[model samples]
Target chain A: MCQLLGMNSKNPADIGFSFAGFRARGGLTDDHVDGFGIAYFEPTGLRLYCDNRAAMDSPLAELVSQTRVKADNTIVHIRKSDDQLLSNAHPFTREIWGEAWVFSHNGKMTIKDAADSDPIKQGKSRHYCPVGDTDSEFAFCYLLNQLKEQFEYKPDARTLYEFLTVQCRFLANYGLFNCLMSNGEWMLGYANTLLFHVTRQTPFGSAALIDVDVTMDFETVNETDDVMTVLATTPLTSDEDWQQLAVDECIIFAEGHMVYQDVPTRPVYLSIEEGLKIAKNA
Target chain B: MCQLLGMNSKNPADIGFSFAGFRARGGLTDDHVDGFGIAYFEPTGLRLYCDNRAAMDSPLAELVSQTRVKADNTIVHIRKSDDQLLSNAHPFTREIWGEAWVFSHNGKMTIKDAADSDPIKQGKSRHYCPVGDTDSEFAFCYLLNQLKEQFEYKPDARTLYEFLTVQCRFLANYGLFNCLMSNGEWMLGYANTLLFHVTRQTPFGSAALIDVDVTMDFETVNETDDVMTVLATTPLTSDEDWQQLAVDECIIFAEGHMVYQDVPTRPVYLSIEEGLKIAKNA
Candidate 1:
């Protein structure tokens, strides 16, 4: 399993404060430290920084945590891989409909079961391909290939949301499929077992990091209309009210606001340990 | 217009010494400083860094130059753009056949003529699309789209080389189309006007930079069998004998050695000044 961290903002914002706490999970506060990756979507294009090293010790990660690289959308993952290959790092990216799509997954997926069910899902028949030997990257490629086959270009928000809702549930049927995906315009999260989100807006107060001893006063940092929504595998702050997303739920956020959400038709909530045990046995 | 720098090595090698001089052209030594990007293909994956700010002034560039990010293949570009948007920076990248393809161009291209010629090249009918409004990115998309349309999988090296020769010549018909492209296995260079390369093998000697007052002894840094071939828009070193490629020529280098070279059946060598004037007036 891996840890995911994501941010969506109404205006351009930096993830420096949040990243400080998140980076600690990679061999410091937690043990998901095989490799790590982060992609920040700037107006110019995507700024992706990845390393096949523990984030706690990587000099590149240190540089990223200290720098104020601002973006409207950001996705980050610290990996605990079954195989710690450099190409197996999380936050795989590809271009779709002329836009860069970024994806990161946190749980094992039974890709063989899914591929056997549909001919289009097979490797040779698919339009997108994974460069690495990870189920996460294979699933990302499969998702984009399906989207490309279904739509000639970017579709309406509602149509896209609906299509993704069905696909997310289908993927979760195989195993835990918690993930975050974005194309710089909008970010979406799917929680099969464990996920959480928190929105910060006007009348903001102070928050203390769960991993480190640092505290940030949002009142001093944010503007009157500034809005930000952050998503993670677990809550990063000790004091804030972090809402746990329901099992099999899919939520999309654009410009720091919830644009669309879908509830599972047949919700079957499972514990994180339960999901891990099944994945391991399979 | 832009300045491109590429390195293909037999073994993992750093471009810090070469890039020190190359980065100087991004703002300090020359005026091609609209933006800059560099992609280094490591064993695990590719590390891509791009900045809209001038490389001389950008802190990111400073860190990149100071770091020893070694790779077997590397592509770098510094732009002098007609539009300075961040998305327009090169070198551009896409994934094809589960492999990452990196590309950079140093001249203007008349994409309108090419798209008008074939329905397959048309935007609505293409498999790949450009996110930025640049002829270079459009050309890269068109090339990849055509390849995907013709071949279901990655073709053999000979077939690919033959196909690219024809396509490279077709693209050069529109305007100046000097470029460098690689899929991490091999690097190819097309010279319609200005491109130069230098190969260094055993008995490596000292060299001096043309842009900055810096000199380095390659003998002290390289192993006995170290082999590297460096390509750039112009000669990077003042002391070395750089070979200028013929007009309409395409050369493919793999593992620091020239694997294939194609000469135009009807060569028309044009000066750099002439190519610039035609691009401006078009």
Candidate 2:
């Protein structure tokens, strides 16, 4: 399978330290080296890069290191392809609703490829559009179409929340729908199967990578005041607080907590941090 | 590798329409058929489910379809593995920081034997405990430890932000680290290489998928006013606007706009509705 990495912080910071140990696994010290892709959110827009070759040997990645493409939001993937085509490459980028969006899938779909295509709209409802042959992309298109059809050129937060829950019901039917998405800030993530995150805030300290012997201190990096969230298909570290999502559950991670969960008769008011705590306990 | 599926919206619409097409790809439709897992975020916490077999073949999944386990947040994954070892699975689950966090990876991470069997830390910044022998878990451990060290348990937002970015950077250096993570309400995504997403709010419209002959009338199914976001390794739809993220960029997707970034200087800020036009003209 492939690996996934994500980060969302309150401020701008570099991903160099984390990448140090992560990159070693991509065909160098380890071997996820089939192909790789990455997406970073800049203040202006997004910066993305993908390579079909071993990431360890990619000179382009070297340039990326030098450029130090900084971003508060980022996604990364290393592929061991089952699709083996350029179209199947990850950290897929596209233009949606006049805004650029980036996405990446960490698992495989179970469909048998009956030459699937976007559904045909039958009424005034908006239709979803697909861009590629990958099932992951098809799911994305279907979701977009559903959103458009449901709203019909309208926008509302409350209504949107309800709509999101409804669509998640459908995604539950898909194979593995574990994914990460970003429009720059406030990263959104969902787990039908598995997804883990570590949110660190206040009281800086020291840490180290398990696979590599590299280490860093938060005190040295910044003013000992930082807020960040890191997500992965699996827990990146064994020491932090990782949260697992529930079946058929849809969450909206805003600011830095799992805020806006839709439950029947449940208290609708809670902070992001509180919601996150509640999710862990549940 | 594995596949992931997720949905976010303002309404409680079921993903059945899109899910139908997506599920087919899980095993019966496509061939991502290694294993299947799903999770949904609810007001209390999250509802999660998983099967060690193809989603299409998993009776549990079929039951789920008919049960309608709904939530505002959702995540899904399908595995394609050649090994029977439980460690070689997708959508791994775990508990962290007093919360339950699940994860799944699609690519391979080669942390290797002895090195992969490190002890996990329960709040220890210097330790990693791997339940499985996958490189993905190792990376997760490293990240968690790094967060601990970076913040040193300060619990400050700024410090947390810097730590994640720095961690992402360090991880990328090892291998492809693209991933998806969430608690319930919002999502945090990064593109170490490749990832795609779309934020759907009011003004819902029509769309189509390039992989299947499916179409969704979001206007009809939705509450006419909704907001949502979708992310993937690639663009899911064809006729919609999907944006690409820059390398090393990380974002916090909240409500519907990017609230946080890793870049030094961001462009002009715009509302959910106005940002599109502003970004377009810029």
Query: By DockQ, who's the top model here?
Result: 1
Query: What's the true lDDT of residue B111 in model 1?
Result: 70
Can you list each candidate's DockQ? 0.62, 0.01
Off by over 4 Å in 2: A28-30, A112-131, A152-154, A247-249, A261-282, B1-282
Chain A TM-score for each of the predictions: 0.93, 0.78
Q: What is the overall TM-score of model 1 with all chains considered together?
A: 0.94
Residue lDDT tens for model 2, A54-98: 567654355455556557788887765544443455676543333
Q: Which digits, one per residue and each the tens of the lDDT, describe model 2 over residues B19-91?
A: 5555667776467776666765544444444555677876546755665544555667666666433333444
Error of 1 at B24 (Å): 0.3
- Report fnat for all candidates as fractions from 0 to 1: 0.56, 0.00
As a whole number from 0 to 100, the lDDT of residue B273 in candidate 1 is 76
- The DockQ value obtained for model 1 is 0.62
Superposed by TM-score, candidate 1 places the C-alpha of residue A26 at a distance from the truth, in angstroms, of: 1.1
Task: Give per-residue CA lDDT, model 1, range A38-82, as digits (tens).
Answer: 999987778887788888987778888878988999999998876
